[model samples]
Target: MYSRLSLSWITSSWAIGLLLVFPVIAIIYQGLQPAGDLFQHLMDTVMWDYIRNTVLLILGVGVLSFAMAIPAAWFMAMCDIPGRKYLQWALMLPLAMPAYIVAGIYTELLDFAGPVQSVLRDLLGWQTARDYWFPNIRSLGGAIVIIASVLFPYLYLLARTSFLEQSVTLMQSAQLLGKTPLQAFWRISLPLARPAIAVGLSLIAMETLADFATVNFFAVNTLTRAVFDTWQGYGSLHAAAKISTLMLVVVVLLLALERFSRRKQKVFQKNMGQESARLLQMKPWQQWLAALFCWSLVVLGFLFPFSMLIYFAAQYFTDSWTTEFIEFSLNTFFIAGVVAVLACLIAILVGLFRRLHVQRGSDIPARLSSMGYAVPGTVLAIGILIPFGWLDHSLNDLIEHFGGKGPGLLFSGTMLALIAGYLVRFTAIAVGAVESSINKIPPSLDMVSRTLGHSPVKMVRKVHIPLISKGCFTAILLVFIESMKELPAALILRPFNFETLATYVYQFVSDEMIEQGALAAIVIILVGLVPLIILSRSIEQH
Candidate 1:
């Protein structure tokens, strides 16, 4: 009976994994098929530009994020600075600010006719455009800066933890050897934390590659935008799928680099207690400088944009408040809620299987399902559309042959497609959350339950579920929040006339009228803050 149950568990896990991963496999298989002209035309025209822009965007974001994050991480982790307690986590606030929203706000302020340059002109006594050489904020360089500003937090979080985990003896030894603080950091600390830094860099790079709205707003022709334009403008799924494949190539490379970095992770990261490491005490002036540097990142990355959002929301309260906004808010909530529940179920299924099975290849289903998280949203959408679109046509054809009215687009043109895309993209978050929680459960509990005549199913229902309930809830919240913020997949898979708050907010942002959507944008930002709150509390407790 246990063997039978084991077979059932493996079969169910595999089935779900294959279904979720099917779109990716389908897209890749379809991408490889010969596309005679339009694909060739795409290759001849904008392909190189897309590749170049994507590479540059990644490279630029990597460099800029590293510069901002490493110093801040070191200050927060090693030096005794004002507000270190809060500043360490406050640095993470920018992660809540969507890249496109930041791009829009900065563009408005820095553009030629906007307040920043206008103020510069007024102060510098320059009258005309030819008289001054202000930077162009709508260019590729601007996109890099804006995206990096928000994304640097990923590096800060990881690097700070890595620094905190280092043994204090090494630092003291370097100091005793007459090395200056800066020199010690450069020679000893930086090399030890290289793996964490590399891992963080890979995350920043992947996110930069995944960004679509920011680049689209800037008119930068990266692979994401290329996929969108080719499919929407040119009416060629074949071309879009091929472009998506190119993006997958980049994502794969980044993932490979991230995994390689992690291979050296255990060697460098010993679990030294944070409090055991003595912090450096800086001079008053140096302390002030450090505080300014840290707070400036908080201000630019989060506080400023968030404050601007609040101001716009208040000023345009009447214009932004509408029946449409409420309806779309409900729409966003409904879809996000459904995806959250479904994703949590998928997570529990696969994660528990991995915990129990423990045999060779047991991890594959979870890994395969998690792969979608690494995929760019645009690529995932194209992958989903290819197979689901075919199934929709086939279903309609079958209905027609049976002399019955067909359910038009039952799969493709409804909430089904959108939900499927969310599951494919975000179930990974749920799985990771659930698996982490499960690992914390004592193995003796599972053994005791089985000895007491509990079946695997009964044991999980009565014991594991209650223990991991908090994790389950956390997983739901994360998936829901991510689904709410998701744009690229929603843009592609949403039913006609459907609008989530993200897409709704994006419409106004794209039209250069962020004030109109400020209220909606605020909702997204507030929702993104939930997990951050949880994270801070967890770190404090630890």
Candidate 2:
């Protein structure tokens, strides 16, 4: 009887185990190859500086993303600044803008032949770029700003949820004890909210580490880019896998830190809680200042890049918006739909199974499933490719021995492999969203179901799942958004003659054809905005 419920549990557990083990298996396969010479080559080159720069960039972006998100969360969640509700949702709008699109816009803005420099040349009589003081956008610092801008929403969403869920009584007690608002926030709020903040920061760090498109675009040699460089740049999969292994080690360390921090904090929200934390009135000047601060982040993150894309897209429409763009759009939608549905189903199972077996070291499966989020998409693709390629070879041999010949299955050449890759890569995101929502359901609902002699499946179907349908939908939406923006895995794994909007954009961008790329990029961003808005609305409800 227990095994019946645990069947789903076992399936999810094995799925999680497979997800975690595949990357390790791929790295070991690469390492077992006779490429000890590449390791020496890596040691002899600027690998140390690459490591340092990557670490520094991660720290820089993590700190900046937090610096931007926390205050905004505090103000929007706790303060009574004008348009607070609007600002709350608006803060999340930047998630719609992909990092590479942000990089492209900044690159154009800072280029000598671009608009800003051109304006300076025309208006201020500047001759050469040497005479100007504008910052270079194609550097490490630029990558930090670009990634941080789009990434802060992760922290913002998590931190704001923590802030919203704080018991009002504790805050009132802090106020009664003669603590000022800021003091109350610092002492009572931030510490209690540390779990959520830790999770958010860990996510940001993981993203900063796993990111490939933006880092590659900016020419920053992070481990992700190093994976590509070693594989494509040097034609050595062994060297690439070594770098990927190193990245996994760093990510595991960070995940451990997040779990430790989360476990240390006591969750104090009582069932019959106090009033919602009261909002304080700000002066007119303060309101405007707050609005300006929030607006500046949105502009830097979303508006500026979006506007640039609109401009370039207009040009592309005039020049080359054709049947190719339409076909790519359809392909993008089809792939995203497949990834979202599959990921959401898997995540729901994982979330439900974990909830049912709450005391059974749920962390094991949870961490393994989430580990895919930490793995770079490109690395995960390679991992999937290795195992699938081997499976195909083995299966084909067996088929030929028994019957006639079997069609070259698995990764030989098929969309199924691509979908599998997407599922493995993005199942973490769906699990996170569904798990978070499931965590909010009271334990009594399931207990009530059991008390009435309901089956475990019925208990979940009737009691637990209905409570979190919105969250499931949001998970699907979020996965859809991510699938649309996914570049590396889709680029590497797509069958011959296949094209996605992302791939179309990449082709144009690779050749410096920014105008056409901008058209496709804009479409991707617009598709992403629907989920971003949905996520924002969900946060507000909390």
Candidate 3:
């Protein structure tokens, strides 16, 4: 028998769920309504270009992500390659880097005036751009490469873990049938890992779809950029909402695929397949080649970009160390801090309600709270903007009815909209962490707490809070880091003159002067590394 649920607790939980989900609902509602000529204008004009580019981007990135990840993943798990120890986790470093930052780094290096081309020009005695043909690093192809370079870790980590967990006997049986190691991997290991790979691919697609700065930087207009331009460029909420709804369709499809893939995930015994004998012995040259491939991804994706950032920052520390940097750093920390604490508290309240209350649909709030995770940030910003914009208008009008100076655009114009957007998008991360920790506590502890004459609140305070404290801290940190790095929502919803490291870096990047903002960019990258470090340590511990 579960503890009796209090009306207040239940009502509060349900209300939180509704509030978190309201933005997405508002987007749908606004999108369904008829907009003026601008909507159709978009439909007839650049809409197909956006669609074609977005589709091509997805296909190119998906195919490339698989190619980049699958072999590295296989090598990590199954081959006796040199540097396997460092390379396995080092490959994940790129995942922490924002795609735009990496794009900017490569753009600088590969551009005609940058060192690579300049050196080539000097060595070959070519005078100018017309003299020799070099691939442009600011095209759709460049965007695909930049995105896949960072995003492939999603696939790599999942595929490698899936490969590790397969039954050893399956591989042995394939080998006994005279299958080469490569043939065995293709026929057996890869097939069984499809569910995990599917889930990973879907995540890659979502991240790729949500990407804005890289595509925008490279002048490749995709749907995400379309949503930003449709709203900010033309100031049409309904038109933006319509575009957002289109993106939501893609999001929904990806999510449904992920859910189905999760259900189809296979279970197996003999999960510990990392034995030395089971590992394939590659020749010395092959080992070097395999290790070099993994290392190249690390260098291109993380090390090279990061080292270049360091060089730029060192060269331009005086320029980057400015009053603006301090202001935006404080702004970022303040906003991320507030969002983290609030998200942590909300996750605790909602998670505990589901765990202890035992009411019908108690888990609904938890489900609803995380739906925003699937929502792209640009769409979510619009979702938040619509309802809150209405609220702001209504409130200001009501105040002005009595001849009072309206707290003008209070909700929508202030940090409220920004905070709301962050909460909706990132609270799910907190909720998942907290819920996982809550699950580890045995049911008997709950019964004991209840039987000691403690009420629900008291029971949680004395028991659940302490046990889940680490998870709670992790939730806060994760939300804080995500809030810090979040670009799209922050870009759309930030108050006038407010900037975070991401937006600040983007400004300099947009102008082809990333060196000026390199210090701030380094700060973002370093902060982003915290969670990755924690994860790496945790993986090593296990």
Candidate 4:
């Protein structure tokens, strides 16, 4: 009976894995069969520019995020500075603010007629563009800042975890050698944290490469934008597929680099017998400076943009409030909730399979399923449309052959396609969370349950489910928030006359009227805080 159950589990896991991977395979296949001369035309005209801009943007964002995250992580994890407690979690709030929204707000604020420059012009007695030489907020540099501000939390979270987990004995040993605190950190702590930092950098790099909205809004032509333009602007799906394939190649390379970095990671087991290293107390001036640094990041990244959104929401409350707005909010919640539940179920299945069937190839299915998280939303949307559109057409033809009217777009333009995209993109988050929680359960529990004649399903239900309930909740909340904020996939796959909050907000942002969608944006941000709060509390417990 257990053998049959295990076989069924492996078969189902493999089936889901293949379904998730099909879009990528379809995209590559389509890219190989491009429309006449379209691939060549893109290569000759704009491919190099896309490549150059994308590399530059990735490098710029990676460097800036590192600079901001590393020091902040050190200060939070190692220094007894003012506001350290509040600043630790407050720094993560930026993850809720989408970079495109930030770009839109700052663009309006810093534009010539907007508040910042208007004040500057009035104070400096300047009249025109040539008066005082303010920087353009719609340039490559601007996109870098916008993206890095929100994304630095990726690095900060990991680096701080690394810092906190370091063996206290090592740090004390360095200090006992008469090394200054700065010297100890520079020579010992930073080197030990490199693996974690590398993971953070790789995450930042993948996100930078995958970003479409912020760079597109700023008019920086990265490969993602090229994919959008090739498909929508030029009406060439084949060309878009080819560009998406190239982008996938970049993602694969980044993944490889990340794996390589982790190959040498050192695990530090805490010697609970020994006292942990003490946090350094800062002088008053240093404390004030540290407080300012952390508060500046929080204010600039989340608070300032959020305040602007609130002000705009209040100003346009009556105009923006409507039955349609409520309907769209419901639509967003309904779809996100459905997708979250589905993703959580799939993640649990995959996690159980990995734990129960620890064979040579057992890990492959989970890895393949998780790969979707690295693919950009734009790429996944286009990839999904190809195979799903073909399936719809094929089914329609089959129906017509039966002397009946064709069923119209059962999969292509419906919520089915949107849910598929969301599952492919976000199931990885759920899988990671669930698997981490599962690893904490003792194998002895499973053996004891089995000895009592419990089936595998019964054991999972009676043992694992109760044990990992918190992780399951985390997985659901994370996927739900992500699906809510997801813009590119919703924009492309949503049925006609349908609007999720993300797509609705993008429409206004694209038209340079974010004020109209500020309320919805606030809702998205508020929902995003649920997982972050959970994460902060978990870290505190650690």
Candidate 5:
């Protein structure tokens, strides 16, 4: 019986691991098959621009995100500022808005013909472009700001968690040695939280690298944009594959840096029973300033874009609210639901396999499976097309050989491919959630269950399932939200005439008709708030 269960665990782990890893393998293989003159043409023409723009965008977004996240995190976690309680969760609201949607809104508002600059021109009596200088919304700098505003929450969440979980004794000791609160924070708290901050920055960096819609919308030539253009614009899948491989290499480097930052860093908690550090009282002016800073981020990052969306939805209700829109919404929900359930199941299988098997390499499968979260959606879409396309071709050939008409694209262009891409992309969230929940359960329960003659499956069903139910819900909710908001993969992989809310919104945004899709964008944002609320509550409890 034990042998059978062991075999089940091993088989399931390897199967899921390979499924997760297959895209990366496919891209690498596609990248290696020589592109001949296509590679040379890219190198001689736009490759330099792609590399330069990608680096600048990553660096710009990283710096700005840290600037926005660190102080807000510090104030919310440690300072007794005015509105701190409200601001704590409000800071996380931006995570609900996709950067591209924000970009679309702001571009309209700040454009030359849009309200902001138009009003400025009317007031100044300016005739034309020669009257005064104004910043371009559709530029590299604008893309950086838009992406950073929506993404800084990644840093804030992690940094706040680190601050909240730090050993109170360390700060108290620093105070005893005559360090002021600010000095102690700078010297002790900030340094100790470096690993957490590094992890957060790495996430932001990967996201910046992965971004396609915002950059493409702005006409910036980043690597992600290059990949899309190379394949769709130039009709060169080989060149696209090469670019995807290059992007993967960059992601791997970022992951390595994150690991290095975490290396040799012992997270000392003093004791599990130790209380968190007390929040320091701020002067009245300091309180007002902190409140202003944090609230400003909340307004700019979430409130402004969300309000604009609502206003547009209201103004265009007749045009935007249609049967087609309803169908799109249903499609989004259907795909998200399917992906969420499958991700949860895979996460459970991998999580349980690692838990039950104490072998030396038992954890490798979980690690491999989660690596896809770091990969860009566009890259993953391209990666998936390779092997699945081949499968479709092989099936069609077999069907023709058997004297039956070929069923076109059995896997590649259908919902099956989209679901597979989503699972590869988001199963990490579920795996992490499940593993954390499982770790909280004592091993003695498992031993006792086994002694009672319960099979491993039955033991999990009767005990682990009920115990980790909340984690399971969280996993499902998070993956669902992510899947709903995902654009690039859905863009590439959806079948003919199929439209998810994200893809639908992207089409409107691309056509500069954002108002038409405003209602759908709002729906996506509202759905995303579920996971943000969950995260906020979880951090507060910690």
Candidate 6:
């Protein structure tokens, strides 16, 4: 009985379950009203276009992500490549470059008056737009490229790990049987890694669906954008909820697909001492080709935008990057830092409890917490607003009744609410990171600790925590970067006049202030690059 109710595990799981489940309940209850009418609206007005655009983006992102991620993962995991360590981090750097920020910078860069067009015009000496046919930024294909550039790392990181953990013997035996390396990879390695790949694909699909900032920035009509138009423009939370419900259904299908794919299929083989084999040497041309591929991804995804930002910053280095920009940068860092630490701690508690409590219902909290990830940032912000508004109203009323000011603390339109939203949305990422890390520790270690009369806390501290220290740090870093790049939640929930780097850039870009926006946008990317590069290199070493 004592073992069954280990305080650390049970308490953590229960709290986590509540946190995860509450918003889902709110979303469903809110969405259920006016269902029939909402469905018709969803069916009628441009909804199909939104759905089609969203679906196409997902499909395109999926194909493109896998195409880039699989080969990169394979190269890092299996082949001898130049700057393998550098490549690992370089690939992950785009995570710091938010899709929307990328959208803003790319829009400026590709605009008729932007540098690309200017350079083209200079080379050809043709002034007018008709003289040279540069593609427009505000189009579907452009949206796909912008989003996929930043999002492929999601697939790359997961698939690389999957590739690295494949038993060398299987690949070697296949090659020994006269199969080429490519044939062996497809037959032996690819199938084995399918589960991880599926998980990655599901995440990418769901993220593509949940995206609001990128689609809106690029002027593509997606479901998330539809939700915003319905709620804000139409002043209809009911309509927004309906759209959210449909989106939830889509997310559920993705979750089901991932679960179905993973069923009875363990990606990680259990045997110890199963290390990855040596990388094969490539011909001179092959080496150059591989290097070119990696470089192209890094350039399109990270370097180009960064270079543009640097140019802007240099022009403003002694000019407009003032005390105000510095303050905004500090505030952004502070909030991101707090959210990262808080979310990680909460995730560990939630994850540990879920691990220890093996009841049939234990999976509920994990599912619920992860639902935040499925929520578009705009919808999640709106969901948070509903409860926050009620809380604020109730508190204000209570204060007036007592002839005094009530504590306007909970949702005071302050940074606090923004941080809470971040915790709710990103806690899943933290939980996932911590859970996967903890899962890697041998169960025998815990058993041994228990047998030695160590308490549960002691066991975790001495055995588990030590083992997963690097993972804990990684989780913290990942959350920090995520929060840094997060847009809609911060924009909607932040107090009047409050700003993060993302919001600052968005504001300028929305008003067509391209030059200053590019400057601030670059700052956000550089901030993301520092940690992303470090984490990527760390993973490669592992």
> By TM-score, who's the top model here?
3
Candidate 5's error at 211, in angstroms? 0.8
Identify the runs in model 3 with alpha carbons over 4 angstroms from their true place.
1-3, 259-269
Better of 1 and 3 by TM-score: 3
Regions more than 4 Å wrong, model 1: 1-7, 261-277
User: Where does candidate 2 stray beyond 4 Å?
Assistant: 1-21, 28-35, 165-188, 261-263, 267-277, 318-320, 345-370, 392-413, 432-475
Ranking by lDDT: 3, 1, 5, 4, 2, 6
Off-target runs (Cα >4 Å) in candidate 5 are: 1-9, 167-180, 267-277
Estimate, for each residue in 1-542, the C-alpha lDDT of model 1 and write its tens digit: 12324677899999999999998997798789988599898788878988999999999999999999999999988999888888978999999999999888988898998998899999999999999898898899999999999999999988988888788878888999999889989997888888889889998998899899999999999999999998889879988998888888888888887788667455444555566366898898998899999999999989999999999999999998999999999999999999999999999998888777767787888988887998889899988888889998999999999998888888889999999999999999999999999989998998898789898899889988998999999999999999999999999999999999999999999999998899999999999999899988887777
Per-residue accuracy of model 2 over 409-435 as CA lDDT, tens digit each: 656368876787787778788888899
Give the root-mean-square deviation of each candidate in angstroms: 1.7, 4.2, 1.5, 2.3, 2.2, 4.1
For model 4, what is the alpha-carbon lDDT of residue 522? 90
Off by over 4 Å in 6: 4-16, 35-43, 81-85, 119-127, 130-132, 169-178, 262-277, 348-370, 394-412, 432-477, 530-534
Measured by lDDT, the strongest candidate is 3
Between candidates 3 and 6, the TM-score winner: 3
What is the per-residue lDDT of model 4 for residues 1-542, given as tens digits with 9 covering 90 to 100?
13335677889999998898888888999878835587798888889999999999999999999989988998988888888879999999999899999988999999778999999888889999986788898999999999999999999999988888777777678778998778988997788888888889999999898889899888999999998888778887788898999999999898898889778676765632322245877789988998898889898899999999999999999978999899999999999999889988888988888787757677777887887898999999998999988999999999899988888988977999999999999999999989999999998998888789998889889899999898899899899999999988887788889999988888788889999989988998898888889888988776
Per-candidate TM-scores read 0.97, 0.84, 0.97, 0.94, 0.95, 0.84
Any residue pairs clashing in model 4, and if so which? none
Pairs with backbone N, CA or C atoms under 3 Å apart (clashes), candidate 6: none
Q: What digit string (tens of lDDT, one per residue) describes model 6 on residues 280-326?
A: 67777877788779878988888887786777777766554777778
**Which model, 1 or 6, shows the larger lDDT?**
1
TM-score (C-alpha, index-matched) for candidate 5:
0.95
Relative to the true structure, candidate 1 reaches a TM of: 0.97
